[model samples]
Each structure stands twice: as C-alpha cells, then as structure tokens.
Target: MSETTPQNPVFPHPAATLILLRDGPDGLEVLVMERHAGLRFAPGATVFPGGRLEAADHHPLWRAHWPEGEPPADLAHRVAALRECVEECGLLPTCAPLSSAVLADLRRGLAAGEGFAAALARVGVAPALDRMTVLARWITPEMLPRRFDTLFFLVMAPRGQEPVCDGGEAVGVLWATPRRLLAEEESGRRRLVFATRMTLLRLAGCADMAAALACAAVPGQGLPAPILPRLVETAAGPVFRIPAGCGFLPLETSAQTVRLG
Candidate 1:
C-alpha cells in the first residue's frame, strides 16, 4: 500500500462491481440499480451491484475461505463487493437464505460483528468465490475528488431467481440488455458511467447469457497501467476516449466486433 492508496481519510475508496445475469422470462438480462441522487458520487446514475469496502469486510474468519491460488491483497475489497451486490440487488447466488438453526448460529458469531470476514467463518458459510470471476477494473480519474479503484465481477443467477432492490440507495431495479441500455443512454431514458458503458459494449458482442457469462470468466493475471485520457471530436461535440487493453478487452460493436476504432 502506497501513501496514495486510500487510507483513513481516503478520498477514493476501493470499490467493486457485481454484474448480475439471468435468463429472464423476456430473455437474457442484467440487473441494474438507479441511484438516489441525494448523496455524492454517482448520484442518480444507473449502475450495477457494487459499493465501497466496509471495515466489516476484512474479518479473519472469512479469510480462511479464500479459493486456491493467491488471495486478493485487499480482502475488504472482496467483502465490500459481495456485500454491495446483496445490498443493492438482492441477487445473492448462495444456497438461498440459510435455515433458521443455521442462521441462528451464524448470526451469533456474526453478532460479534467480526465484519464480513470472521463472520463468514463463524456462520460456517463460505461464499462460493469460484462462482465469481473478475471481469474488469476501472479507476476514476484523478481530477475527480471522489475516486475509486473498482473491480467488476460477473455472477450468473440460477433460473427463476429475480433481483430485488433494498429500496434505500436505489430507486429502480430492473433487468436490461446492453444494447437496450445503450439506446436508453442515447435517449433521455437512462445514464451510464464510463465503466458501465465499456462493460455493456463488451457484452453486446456476446450472443446470449451463457456465452456472456463464459466470456466474463476468462482470466488474465496482469495489473494494467492506469489509462490516460484523450480528446475525440464527435458530431454531437467532443467525446473523450481512454486506451484499452486491460485484463478484459475494451469492445464496441460497430459494423465490426466493437466501436473501439
């Protein structure tokens, strides 16, 4: 951790993304939440399941459950990610809510308030981390006062499951397609952050839910250098573009595969 890494008064907290996917009655769709807009940072923006790392996220009990290979350097990041997903979308991919007896035991340990880590252990429920795959990472520009180093994860929800919003932070929760969302962005119907736009473009290339989830799981092990900004002139006005080639490909569906051109 560098001096620049977010600390106590961290201006830019580490964040995570939960891309919820399911084969809905209409077709394949992704879960999205609309922000309340009263607070700072991404206010009123439509986003995926995600939020900042909370202190409870780093409990030692949960640490024991890490999947094989190397554990993430920041466990808080992971806990925040999973917690945010549940809090925001209620699309938890676990074995439903635990039975009453199991829930009691876990809640007691969790009452110790060990945070997401130790509590996860005490509860005896190891989150199926294997089901989650890192899809992309994004850092808000330094120019912004509120910044974040965010990791996006993709998880497939089983059939018949629906995403429910907590109704606090988010005003609307719905399943939408990338292409449809993009069109919404073009019209006055919706708004998207840069990262959301990028992710949607990548998904647009995927034929269906299964294919999209499969593509999301393809892993790469390099930490990308932070992207720099550039100026681009569009007919509407001026649009900025950032360089691609992170762990995941930056894709745009043009007449070709994407509009990365």
Candidate 2:
C-alpha cells in the first residue's frame, strides 16, 4: 500500500531493526543497506536491517535461547532484530564465534526457507541478545495506510564476520560514519527516510562505539518515549513535525522530502 494513501487507521505492526556499529579508522561507522527499489515499503531508501516481527520470533522455544535475567519487555524485538540482520545482511550475533563457512551455510539455509531458531539450533549457538541496547522507538504517523511500531537496537558488529546484502530486500550494503552518511544525503547521493536521518543525527554526536553505548545506557535513563510525527501544512508546504526534546534537533522537515514508509 502507498504510504501517502489515506485509509482507516490500523494498528501498527511491531518491527525491529539493528544498528550495527564499529570503530573505523576515521571513527564510528554504522552498517546500512539500500532497500530494493521494487519493494512495497521504503523502496530504495537507505535503512538498517529490519522487518516486521514473525510468529517464530515469539515462540516459547526462544526462552531457552535468551539470557538468564528477567526478559525485557522487548526481548522478542531483539530476537527479530538479530534474525532480520541475518536474513538481510548475512551477519549473525551469536554467543560464540562461528567460522565463515558456517555463516555462509546458515545464510544459504535461511535463503532456502530455514527458520531462524532452527538454524541457530542446528549450529548449537544462541543469539547474544545481551549485547543489544535500545536506541529508539518510533511509530509511523497515523496518516499513512501502512504503519509500523519499530524499535531500533544498537550493537557492536561481531568480529570475524562480514556483511553481504541478500540482493533481494536489500540490494546493497555499506559501512560509513554517520557524518559521512549525512553528508551524502546532503549531496543527494543517498536517500534517508525521516527516522533514519534523525537517527543518524543522533549518532553523529558520538565519536565512537563506546560513547554511543554509554549514552544509550546512562543511569536511570528509561526507554525513550515513542515518537509519532505529525503532518502539518504551512504556507510553504506540508511538513512533518516531531515533538521537541526528542534528542533530534530541528524537529521539522518538508513532507515532500521525507519518505514515510
């Protein structure tokens, strides 16, 4: 469905995405992929690896795979994030190191319709869910026909593993510092949706992964409030306005320039 199409509002599907980060020679770098231009949602926009949650993500079997602590309210979101990361980018965050050959085989299995949990079981590994940190939560504006309540998770990229775009949902993948990405967007070399642009702006404040994680884990800093942008008509044109003090500066943008899927 077209995001701009006005229809009866529906509950936003729960979704999760991973923001893979690492310390590059220049500084902090994040992994992003270009969605296939033919896709129904967020077509051709640069985005983190993610998708709507699946039934498998919430299966009780997952209880054996996560950590020991009281499971977070968003534990299933983290599971979905890791699963999507593997499906879209060919990277797995496991509790133990996996050989490149094993990773490739798992990717092939997933492509051939293997369930994520089953694949993990075959490999005798569990997802390193403890490594993930909540970054942000956003709900698609109600004006859109298709909407998602998506959680953004941050984690350091697992060492000894490389990312490969699946060439279907994700057509290309790259690692670049947030500043570089923002610069590319400014030059029109890349297309970033409103949430992605704002996310990058937030990440741009950190010099490296450690700082970013520390910022996310500050004491008593609870999960961020869900941000639901509003579409407003100004004399200039339509613009999307997010609430103030959401950590993203200059909270308004021309609607024509923002991709809402």
Candidate 3:
C-alpha cells in the first residue's frame, strides 16, 4: 500500500485593520462590526473595520496624503486602513464638506471595484494618514483553512462622525468598552476572535483614551513582530498555543492554550 502525505495549509493574504476608539460613559470604547454570515472569512465573527490591501491602494495619488516623517515602507497599510474605515463605517478623516449623496456614491463606487484614491479624488477628500497609529500585527494560524496576515491600526474617530455599518460585509456595529465586551465574551453572551479578545484585554487596562494611546506609543511593546500562533491537538480538541514573552499580552503558561472559535 502507498503511504499518503498531508498537504500544507493555504497562506494568509496581507491585510490591514483599523480599530476606532473613543471615550464612552464608562471608559474607553472600541468599535466593532459583525461580519456577514454568508462571507467566506470569519463569517458571523465580530471584528474591527478592515480588509485586505488592494493594488489600487498604492496609487501615486495617495503619496500626497502621506504624513510628514512617516516611513514609506508601510504606507499601503495606512492607506488601506483609512479606506476600509471609510467604506465600512461611512467615516472619513477628511473634513472636505461632502454631501451625503456624494459620500454614498463614493462608498458605492469604492465597493464596486473602483480605486480608493480615485473615489477620494472624485469627492475631493484627502486621506488622513496621520490619524492612524500602528498597533499590532497578527498572522492567522496555519491550521485554519483561511488566513490573513493583518496589521492593526488604532485611531480616534473623526469628531462628529458616527460609525454605521454598510449592511453588506458587516450587518451591525456597536461601540463598547473593552472590559465590558471581554466580560460578555467570558459569559458566552458574545463571541470574540482571539486577536480581538487579546486587544481588548490590553485596552481594558487603560483608564482613558490618553492612557491607551500612551501605552500604544511604546515601541516594540505595543507593535511587536507578527504573532503566529501554533496549534496543538489535545484530548479536548484543537487548542492554539500563544508563546509567552512575544511582546503581546503574556500567556499564563509558558504557552497559552486557546480555542479557535
């Protein structure tokens, strides 16, 4: 009999995510949207506003929007984050007085495969590269059928802009304190992906927006190398092992076990 060999898992696509934050009545709150149930990736999971980077994101027109002193190496991530934020939440950093009709048209055009820069040009809005800060990078575990090497960016929402879901990729949206959401997840009332859960845990320690931003500013501490978790099979089932001292929240054990929900 011939022996069978196992195949390698599919590689994750490079993607960028933006975590919009603001002060809530209780404490610092982060925006989250529920993925459409029919979507292929992370269906029905709650996630921050973000998506994979598109080639159009690197259009030359975006260069004019780059912030002073910002390195060029990861400009695409910043652009993609901002674009996705606007598309997913109907919020843009640009203060260029756009009519609601114009904004809706831009979103529709962007969603229909139009380049983000071109859409912005049509609406006369400049990208707000300065508003976003790189928070962390996470690579989806190899054990999963789908994966994404995603960059997470943190930014305070533009003043007077309310975040609303597009009703397509995302069906609903809400803002809640990290502590409150984490507790709800623990009680099984809510579902959170591992990365989102860990992020909330870190933010939960912050007393306010300033404290959170201060914590995020610490180099290598807040933005560490891409976190690639390993999968370990156990009697209970598959559990992901997050290594300790990896610059993210330290695992309780030398390696922390997590269910891939």
Kindly list the per-residue Cα lDDT of model 2 for residues 1-261, writing each as its tens digit.
Answer: 112435677789999989999999999999999999999888999999999999888987777765685666777888999989998999987788988888888888888999988888787767898789988888898887788999898999999999999999999999999999999989999989888988898899999999888766332234568888878777777788888976666677888888776
lDDT of each: 0.63, 0.86, 0.75
Error of 1 at 215 (Å): 2.7
In model 1, the clashing pairs are: 56-115, 56-116, 59-118, 61-118, 62-117, 252-258, 252-259, 253-258
Q: Give one digit per residue, the lDDT tens place, for model 1 in 1-261.
A: 111222343355677888877665555678888988785767777888788876556666555666676666545555677777655655455544444455445444433554555555556666655566666667774445667777787777634445566677878898888778878977867877777877887887776778777775345454324443333444444444456554344322221211111
Model 1 clash number: 8
- Candidate 2, position 193, lDDT: 83
TM-score of each: 0.73, 0.92, 0.85
- Which candidate, 2 or 3, has the higher lDDT? 2
Ranked by TM-score from best down, the candidates are 2, 3, 1
The residue ranges of model 1 lying beyond 4 angstroms of the native Cα positions read 1-11, 25-27, 67-75, 95-114, 117-124, 158-161, 217-238, 247-261
Question: Quick one: best lDDT, which candidate?
Answer: 2
